[model samples]
Target chain A: MARAGLNAERLTRAGADLADELGFDQVTLSALASRFEVRVASLYSHVRGSADLRARIALFALAELADRAADALAGRSGKDALAALANVYRDYARTHPGRYAATQLRLDPETAAASAGPRHAQLTRAILRGYDLTGTDQTHAVRLLGSVFHGYVSLELGGGFDHSAPDTEETWSRILDALDSLLRNWPD
Target chain B: MARAGLNAERLTRAGADLADELGFDQVTLSALASRFEVRVASLYSHVRGSADLRARIALFALAELADRAADALAGRSGKDALAALANVYRDYARTHPGRYAATQLRLDPETAAASAGPRHAQLTRAILRGYDLTGTDQTHAVRLLGSVFHGYVSLELGGGFDHSAPDTEETWSRILDALDSLLRNWPD
Candidate 1:
């Protein structure tokens, strides 16, 4: 019998909330079972197990993040678009750290292709369209941008910049400025 | 009484090796006890528990990485120093994935001050001396470089660049080139 209030979608949202609270690593099936006041076996009907639950959360977070990126990209280009996209990630990570971490989960090839991963790449490409890069140069710039954003956000969230001077915000803007300068004058 | 042939250093080394085999999360006091063929209680004599063991591993990894970075940076400047420092992290992470992950563990303020973390920052600053950055600009550059290197290595390690076109090596060199170009022409 299907539970009136419990389904994969509902469970995923709850699990995501739990992840934000306890962290992505702590959002286990047993923990969710406890939260829902349901048996672990019952959850198996809605989702396969722990891995499946995490995968669902990952997919959910990816879609949500991609949507935000798309919204941020509308009618923006160059450094404006870059800052918009970058801030979306930094803001999402700060506000929903667990969900942010979940987006980093490595999905299998088939699942990854079906997820918002491609949209993320496309959105990044859109920002690059403002630059003069093309072909492999564009791909390289995409990877570089991905690295800086991911690295900076992960470090900031992990307290890597908590003790540093000059403030993270200053560094963030300067880094963006530097990226804009680099993109405009990309070397051979 | 201390156990013969067993000490904190030895246990930490064994734990780091086990982390490489099973991942950092899987390295626990009980697991180390099993590896040592002793009881967990006996293991506690050497280290407080799981947290202490992990902290020690983090410090050890940080020191090892700093040492390698310092060595790679010898007799190099400008882009050479940058690439050398970047390559040390990438090679160390590829060879010692577990230990590399350990270096990222968030340490308490006091512990962080005492760890090789400061040296890692100093080494980064040393690279910045090759450019025109100073004061906050230098700090911003430091944070930016840290983010790119950390972000790129992490994504690569997590297979983010796998299944993508142009191969990671090409992207890596191009990123270094772009970074070199950016540092040379940082915006005002």
Candidate 2:
């Protein structure tokens, strides 16, 4: 019989916690079952399988990150908003490395379309409003910002900046200043 | 007796091929042994364990990528060199997704110091020579370029750019142009 108190929400929360404790890639249905002290079969009632569990976790992470981004971006504009948004991502990654990694999971087309990804894109466009870009230029700028934020954070978390001169914080601030300047004076 | 044809180099090469076929995270000592039709114990003579195998693969990928970058940068300067370097990374990632992913693995400080990572830094600085940046600003520029190239390629591979209009290629070319322009006019 299915566990009386277990449900997908609770199970997924536990799974996310497990991911945080272990690594995201270490998450599996078998491990979650062990954590719950239930048979692996019991999990099937809540989560379809490993793939379903991962997809749920990915959705949860996207929603959570999107919420944080939206909150950080509130009541801010221009460079302030840009910095706030960028820090939100970096801070979240540092605090919740597993969940942040989950946010990078490649979902199927259907799941991706239904994900909070569009909200992220909209947020990026909102930041671009402070600058004068329009049309294709705006789209290109969005990709650039996404690349920088994602790349820098991934590299930092991977220890790329460790044992190097000039602390990462200084480099981060300088990069932001350069990005803001570049956006302000975007080429024609 | 140890397999006559089996050695650490051959095993590492086979492991790299396995990584390319089944993804790096899936490569294991047991799998390689099975591939060789040898007992797992017999393979230990050739590879210390899975960790050693992964480290070797990472080192191999780094050297290969650095070599490609060196070749691409030869006889090129300015934006041409930048574009060539960026394309090398992108193309390599597209052609060898597993090896490219391995290049992102976190090696110990000692292992990293001995890897071709410093060669990559030198090449990045070489490209920066075309710009007027020096000292810390040059370091910041190197980080920025690394972030963009790594981030954009990671996102593109993760299907973040799929189903979008204006095409990813357009964005890539425009991003390079913007980067070149930004480097030319870096703020004081």
Candidate 3:
């Protein structure tokens, strides 16, 4: 029988907490076992190993992010929807850096297809409904937005904007404004 | 006496090559020592340890990237300059994933200030000269471009765009177009 308080979900959540505290790279099975006061062999019953634990954490992060994004996009539209969705990612990264990092883990195709990855892509597409894009233009815009949101947040988190004047929050709002303008008047 | 054929510069360069072959996280003093077929202790003369070695590699990558950005930005302006600069990052990341990852490493403020990091900022500012941005708008635009460039390259490298339709090249060029239009329009 499984341990009274330990299951795959429970262990995965603990691993994520460990990641948030010590960083995703540090959330190994052994470290998790130590945290749970169990032997590494005990974790093997719940998680295959380090990679499996990491993947589960990654999937968990993706699902959590998708849930937040869905909620943020609930009633918003146009630039409102755009900003809301963008904030979902940036805010998630800020509150949960380690889990955010896990979301970037490159999953195998089969696993990724089954994960919340598609929900993310779909949410991005829904944001485009507010703009005047179509055909390949929609696809292009989606990629552009993904790049900007991911790029800006990671750079900010990495201290890329620390030494610069005009704080990041101001820049972020302006970026959203600029993106809105770009989408409204996308080039031919 | 020091080893006849080994030195700090050579070790750093070899470490970078190892990064390109393996991932950046895998580059360590012990690993570099194995690559050089020398005792790990022998490397203490060149580097403090794994962190020091990684920092050196990061500095090397920042300088190399700055050099390439400068080369790409020369004799170009407006969209021409923008495309050239953008391509520099994408091409570099594609050709040298590990070294590219090193460029993202967070260094101490003093080390970052002395490194070629500032040159990257200056080159980015030069590209903005082609546009009408002034004051913090320039800074915001700079941040935006950095975010987009870094974000897009990392996502593409991570296969975020692999499962999508419309080849990344098409989306890339369109993104450039959208950025150019946004910069030229400069929402009020």
Candidate 4:
């Protein structure tokens, strides 16, 4: 009965919720089917397999995150733009920890190429365009931004900032100031 | 029988190597025991269980990485220090992919407190001191350094940098230059 009502979109949303509850790694087809109280073969009509389910989750997370980034970056420029962009990720990771984890799953090259990952790069480049970086340097700056943003967020999510020092949020704000300044004065 | 010759150290090293080959998640005690041509019971004598084996691999990777950082940072300061520190991690990941993956495993707070991970933070702080920051800003700087270094290396290792543009090496150099500049002239 439930199989007739199930669709890829609904299954993927269910999978994302399951990811939030039991950590991302535990979201498998069998487990998902059991959650839906549907037989495995019945569930197969909606999801191709576990990998397909995961890819859908990843796509969902990416689109949601990209939308959030677009909102934060709107009407913001310079250091303000940088801070807002960085905050979007940190906030998302804190709020939807499961969906955030799904964003980091290994996608095949084609899936990755087609995902909202490009939107992410485009947004970063848009911010950088306001700065004075050139060709190869611009490319390098994009990579640096990607690395720092991904790195800090992942670590913070992993509790790398639970120390008795200044909280990571404060640190994150300062790093953005530093990054904005770094972009403004990229070296020769 | 081989539990007779095996101990925690050997098991940890073997686990790290196995991680390098099959990946961190794939490095199970049963798989490792088979590799050693021994029984699973023998491995238990050296390592308490699965979690213990993983913790040991994480410890081994952290220490090896820290030692490599020390060697690279010796007689180096400022930009040179940053480059040396950055290369050590990237190189380690390239050479021992599995061990690097194990290093990302979430350790228990107590185990993490007892890990060389602190020494890693200290070394990073020391490198920042070679720049000009102090107090809480130093902590921020340290977090930034950790984020960029770990983020870039992990992304590159995971093929996040295999774009149709310039190679990751060139991007890495420019990133180092950019970071050095950022550190040298951290914004107020």
Per-chain TM-score, chain A, candidate 3: 0.96
Candidate 2 lDDT by residue in tens digits, A61-116: 88999999999999999999999999998998898888888888889998899999
Model 2: which docking level applies?
A: high
TM-score of each: 0.95, 0.95, 0.97, 0.94
Candidate 1 docks at the CAPRI level of high
Using TM-score as the measure, the top candidate is 3
lDDT, candidate 4, residue B16? 92
Q: Please give, for residues A88-139, the per-residue lDDT of candidate 3 as tens digits.
A: 9999999999999899898998898899988988999999999999999999
Index of the highest-DockQ prediction: 3
TM-score of chain A of each: 0.96, 0.96, 0.96, 0.92
lDDT of each: 0.91, 0.90, 0.91, 0.86
Clashes of each: 0, 0, 0, 2
Candidate 3: list runs displaced more than 4 Å: A1-4, B1-4
Over 4 Å off, model 2: A1-4, B1-4
Q: Write the per-residue lDDT of candidate 4 for residues A75-186, one digit (tens) a residue.
A: 9888788888988988898888889889987789998999998899888888887899888787788889989999998888776766548877688878888888888888
- Tell me how candidate 4 scores on lDDT: 0.86
- Candidate 3 clashing pairs, residues 3+ apart or interchain: none
Q: Give the DockQ of candidate 2.
A: 0.86
Q: Give chain B TM-scores in order.
A: 0.95, 0.95, 0.96, 0.96
**Of the pair 2 and 3, which is ahead by DockQ?**
3
Q: For each candidate, report its DockQ versus the true two-chain complex.
A: 0.87, 0.86, 0.93, 0.88
Ranking by lDDT: 3, 1, 2, 4
Give the DockQ of candidate 3. Answer: 0.93
The runs of at least 3 residues in candidate 1 whose Cα sits more than 4 Å from the true structure, single-residue gaps closed, are: A1-4, B1-4
Q: What's the best-to-worst order under DockQ?
A: 3, 4, 1, 2
